[model samples]
Target: MSSAVDTLEQSEAYMENPKLQKYFKNVWLKEKERWVSMYRVGKMRVPVGTNNGVERQNRMLKECHIKFQVDKSLSGLVKVLHKDFLPAGYKKYIDENALASDSYRSYLNYIPPYLHNRPPKIVKHCMKRLNNASSIPTDDVTRVGCTVFKVRSSESLLEYEVYFGSESEFPKCSCPDFKKWFLPCKHMFAVFNKYDDVSWNSLPKWYSDSVYITLDNYVIKTSDYNSLKQSDIALSR
Candidate 1:
């Protein structure tokens, strides 16, 4: 990545343009650590390498929700966001995903009778990756130690070292996806599938954070309330 950056910096267009040179030296170089995937990997939990999520949200707010509301006061804008846009968006998400069932919502307060011991969304993601691990042939998974393994990518064929740590430590994979997201990648799942007695306690504490669980509960309740309100409207009609 650094080599590519260096090559771009040495390009004729970059060398000729003083403003471009200034921006590259002053802003890009200084802020590279925050935006660069190579620098950010293993340092942050979010796997996103760009500000695309924030940019997309901002674009939605400006273009879709507030395009013709330039005369509105700050409080009125907040009202639109809190009372109209956000609720509608959340309801749409919940309805489309079908995530507001009573049984699923109950898992927020207690550990579900599951192996992963993570939030519903997280557990789903991990299980999806675990299923994908089956695509990687057994020949790709080479055991280096009792708790260590070298798993080769079925696509890239590149080898990654996976370490399933003890109860006190978290598991780790050398794969870029695991390093960037701080989540279990398919390579680690391959090792887990191979071993029957692998410890689930080795997962990071963030997976079990109360804050995320609470947020999930709040979303579920909001969805349930919206559904009930819609049903009431239909009954009245």
Candidate 2:
């Protein structure tokens, strides 16, 4: 178990209830290699940690579409869901209404240079995380060194260490996002927020580069793909 996992497992007695123990043993424990660590999950760059986010969005869609007497045909519904429901709700609730909140409006304008080349989805994801980090009290962030800090979580009462390394090394966090995915997690952002000097320039190269390029390979060698094949050279035509 130790060899397969980077972190320690919860205590055996923590799941002592028979029902909880059975589920933990049969499901979570058995699948520990896949989901136990943030490192494992982060490498995949999965946009979701759980289906709840999707489910919640879907529920919102249903409420908005159904209550408003919108078109019901499958195609019409799909179009309205995107073109009407989601966008409208986002603009009305999150964006337009955001002007009322100083913090929200500030976050909207706060874009980093490295994020400029990223896809819109990735930008939004980072923004969401940044917003979350903002909610954490700045006083909770304790600097230990020029490049290291400890962030105390208000809700969980847990402390995560963040390291903003140099050119030879990327920034990292003791939290799972840094440990496994190599991406800066909210805790790292919280520490970064404390500094006026920090920007996406401090981010790992992998974060700003397109993830699709990382996932797939495309090679065109001058001697191979670019150069004519021997058979083509030999052909009379």
Candidate 3:
């Protein structure tokens, strides 16, 4: 068997055994199993290397509004989970499954046109005040699609939302500003613009705008990416 296949099988064997799977769940089995399962289960390997989509968002939820010492009200937590977590996950899912079936048109509709286009003038004006090269939210570096917030001056950095997918196709930005003003924020523009890897999930918060854009490759990365990309995702019994 090919090396990739062998590695994949080993992963399956380990996952099938509950005893073996726990090691992975606890972050024990480093690379061999971690990547094998990630690519196999997440089904995609966008720019970020694996489907860190869900994990990244969760981390943001805890770090931003949910501090460890302070406890939020039940209703507040619900708002955070619904308004924050659920939409983040669904956005990633919809972006991946778009164009797969006519039924997914509802999701596709959310992807805005001029998505790839640069931010509008008014948004651009707002962005001018906040153009720092190193201003990402959250020290936790594992997550992607974070919502960056401005501090007292929109400069020093305050908080960020874990944005996973863009509702737009082209100049994809996950920030609410993308919708409120139709301009790609620095983070979204920065990530999508630079990386030609087609896997946005892998790229860091920086280097997004520094890269040039091209038409040859522009596929968004999602959790189910690996399965969808592979022709052999499913087999007939």
Candidate 4:
């Protein structure tokens, strides 16, 4: 990433434009950490790299719900959204099985089929990466300790260390992807396939906490307002 930036800095087009160069150095360089995914951590690491979803939803609201009507008053718009749009969207969500009853199960009650306990989206990502894990040569994955393994990258031929920690700590990997995303990488999955003893306890609490809050909030909103307030308090702590 730095190399790419350096190359851009040296380009004739960039050098010729004084304002562009000033903007690049003063704004882009200074704020790179905010925009760059590699510098993000914790919840920011989730794969929300694009605003396409927001843009699409906005487009839907304008085109479908408002029907490009610009003359509606504030209350009129709210009435349309509350009475016509939101309910329709909610019904569609339920009809599509997006909000399943199983999703509302408490952490203690939820027993994931996979070794690691993750949100469905993350589980799907890991399932896709399993193919890459399978392709890894057994010789490439060297067990360093009971909780540590070194897996060589297929593309770069660089060895990255994968660390399996307790339930309180997130499993770590030396790979750039893991460092950037704070999520399990292919190397971690490789270790999981190799070792039978590693269980769901190896996963961090953050994912489970996030899942619990999201599911519980969704169910509690209409059923129990006090429970929602309690959930908020727990989250704040």
Per lDDT, the best of the predicted structures is 1
Model 1 lDDT tens row, 1-237: 779888988899988999998998899899888777777544435434466888987888888888877558899789879987898787766653334344333333322244222344555566678779878887888888877889987778689999865555656788877776666788877876666765454454554343432234445544544354332111012
Q: How accurate is candidate 1 locally (lDDT)?
A: 0.64
lDDT of 1 at 173: 88
**Any runs in candidate 4 off by more than 4 Å, and if so which?**
1-30, 41-44, 52-54, 68-71, 86-112, 115-120, 137-139, 154-156, 166-169, 212-237
TM-score between candidate 4 and the true structure = 0.63
* Ranking of predictions according to lDDT: 1, 4, 2, 3
TM-score pick, better of 1 and 4 = 1
Candidate 3 local distance difference test against the native: 0.40
TM-score of each: 0.64, 0.43, 0.23, 0.63
What Cα-based lDDT does every candidate model obtain?
0.64, 0.58, 0.40, 0.63
Error in Å for residue 205 of model 4: 3.3
Candidate 2 clashes between residue pairs 3 or more apart in a chain or in different chains: 39-180
lDDT string for model 3 (1-237, tens) is 257545754786875888766765466545555454433431222234347867876777788646752548888788877786678666544443333322222212322232222222322333442343235332322233243322221343433332433333233333444444333345543433333442344333332332222111233333344444322211110
Q: Could you give the C-alpha RMSD of every candidate to the true structure, in order shown?
A: 6.8, 16.8, 20.9, 8.4
Backbone clash tally for model 3?
A: 24
Q: After superposing candidate 3, which stretches have Cα over 4 Å from the reference?
A: 1-3, 7-46, 49-51, 68-73, 81-237
